[model samples]
Target: MRRTTTGPRDLPPLGVQQAFRLPETADVVLPEGLRVVCLRSPSAPMIELVLRIPFLCATENDGATAEVLATTLLRGALGRGEEDVDTELARAGCSLGAVRRSDRIEISGSGPSAALETLVGVLADVLTGASHAGTEVDRARRRLAERLPLLRARPSTLAAEALRVHCRGDSPALRLIPAEAAVASVTADGVRALHRAAVVPAGAQLVLVGDLDPERTVALLAARLREWRSRRPVGTVVPRAPEHWQRPVRLVDRPGSVQSLIRLVSPAPARTDPRFAALSLANVVFGGSFSSRLLSNVRERGGYAYWAGSRFDDILEAMVIAVNADTATDTTVSAVAEIRAELRSMATKPVTDDELRVAGNYLLGASALAMSSQVGLATAVSTTIGFGLPPQWLESFSDEVRSVTGRQVRELAEEMFASATFTGVVLGDARLLAGPLGEHLDMVLA
Candidate 1:
């Protein structure tokens, strides 16, 4: 056992501090075809690795499969059970995570730089040399399956699920709910096959950020992960244009519910689009933050909802505006109508100079505050790599927000609000004091 003086782990003294921004990532094409994009953050006393791969949920079926894959990741890896792995992480003073979203599969972790070797070794073991016999999978399947009954007991969860089923149509995101069933369907063969197909070499980016020497860190990683191989090609068939893009405005009928939870989603610029900056600024002014238009109208003046704001999903694939509050169900009609009106107003009227200034300031200031911490800085760097952005992209964020004029915001609003361009999703008891909503917006009863 080692005793430390002051540091959290009481590890040996560190050597150096190095600042970095998207340094030329060393492309170590492994013999097994895995791509290693390594960025050494030598300044901090921690090393973080993001084994993010391009796992696309192209179709609903594919998405469902991914859902199963994400949860079961911690269930067992490297012949270890979830309990063993989770406990190991705790003892290491490290955290490991898995996120399977509509767009991609993100697996990331961080730990004291003193344990950089242990961190990378375990990570590579889980990602590449993983297999837990069959006991872990069988145990996880039963545990996850037992939780399905709980969703029915919660009104909010039920209504949200209903809306997703309606709006997503046959998308995998909707199908992958109640994670237990998804786990049960995943056999060891199915799991391994998915890993081979989805989590291969070209899909992997072993992002290393920490206080270790750049050369040494890469050297250590190369030594451990040298034999790890990628089993499949880089990409998958991309999901087609969403069939439910103009899904009927669904009022998920949650009986006896007091407040309405409204969520509207529509297509936004893709991550690869050049207009991302402009759209990002537009989103800020329109509904990106707490002091956004939707908030001003719904909470400030109309006194309808307490929490109302919208944001562009950082992925840039879609823009979703979520608003929730505990008001009478009877007020739902007026509330929904008011939100729609606010959208039109944002599109038509020029944002005030004060509005532009405040929003831009918040955007810029928030960006700076976010990047101030070690974890935040690591996250920013990981985001840059995961979402495909340039090294100097963060520097450009404030400038873009400041340059966004009232004119630009108005233009974006009108462009975004065009008919059928957006779909509305409401989680409430729809049968409460309803007017003719289907005449304008597509309506569905969830």
Candidate 2:
């Protein structure tokens, strides 16, 4: 666990006078090179461990590695069979989790103090033994075969994939990895090779929080990982994908659909940009929530769709604004027009002080609202470390957000949204969308 000495750089502005403030945690360094920021609180009977590895899609230039590595981790490991891991975990009533984000793979879950050993052992095996058995590969293939066709039926899911394809450019984010083609193409040796280099003990972190004795937790992790070993992650830069990954419009052509699927996207500000705070708040006013401009214009006022919202894909390198909805095919063009108008209004106009406060409060409030659990806090810390934001970033985030003025929000908005690199994807009857939508957008009619 890391020592909790606050550096001068770690001071946060005395922002919110409300909320249960998170404690200052120590940055824990392990025997190999694993780094973890741990916060130990013996306030409960269970301990939550969130392990964050720095190697991610950004590092490899291909986003699929993290997903592939995570999925392949269950076959066997460190002399313990897959059944042994499940039996041990069931005996202890413990849970394991794995998430792949832009910059890291976050492993998190919890169990009682008495169950910690079993949890540790299971993780050790998972990190060391993941075999790509032919049977397991076939099982994964069968699962994907069942799930892939279903994904094509959902608009929201398709739009998200489209956003990834647009933002990341021809990567597996849109296609899903290891592609059915790639997965079918996966060999035992290939999986073994990928695991040997990427799944090193040193390449992973084990974070212990809540009711954990720092000393004991450290000891357990050390013993469990003693033989896990470490290997330096391979580092090589991948050329940047093009800004416009696919064409502007990709009509998936789902005929006779009750609602037309609308996907509107364009790259936006990154999380680390100086104007990030403003962009964030600006986004709130744009489409971060139900109170956003898009919702107000496209839904409430224009009555375009059943639902609508925009999300920021901010992480290691890039970020984007994505909007989706299910509406009538005839309203598709009008909804897209309203969305652009809202984007332009945000960019060209200034927000009100009242608007700024509302956005700030919502953003900050939302953070504390969701993190009311130990698991949530663990996820927050993992992302914070993965993003490499300043130590006081969260502590000071409220103030930065509140301090943002209307002018700043408008300025940031204009800078980020000027190009209008809009992508309009309608995943319904392609014949219905034959009109002016493409003239204003980089349109690809499927």
RMSD of each: 8.7, 8.7
Tens-digit lDDT track for model 2 on 1-446? 87866766655654563644666466666778766556666567777888776554323223434455566566566565668767777789898866665445667778887787888788777776666665665565566556656766667676655555544555333343334455445555655666676666564655666766666667667777777777756453433645563345666566676567777666665556667788888888878987987798899999987777887754235556766677887787787677777778876667777787778778888887656567777767666665656435666665677677788888877766553566646776666675666655666665
Candidate 2, 280: how far from true, in Å? 1.7
How do the predictions measure up, each by TM-score?
A: 0.79, 0.82
Best by TM-score: 2
Task: Give the clash total for candidate 2.
Answer: 7
Off by over 4 Å in 1: 1-43, 56-92, 152-168, 173-183, 233-238, 242-247, 314-328, 417-420, 433-442
For lDDT, the strongest prediction is 2
Query: How accurate locally, in lDDT, is each candidate?
Result: 0.62, 0.66
lDDT of 1 at 63: 51
Clashing pairs in 2: 2-26, 2-27, 2-28, 41-211, 76-129, 77-129, 249-444
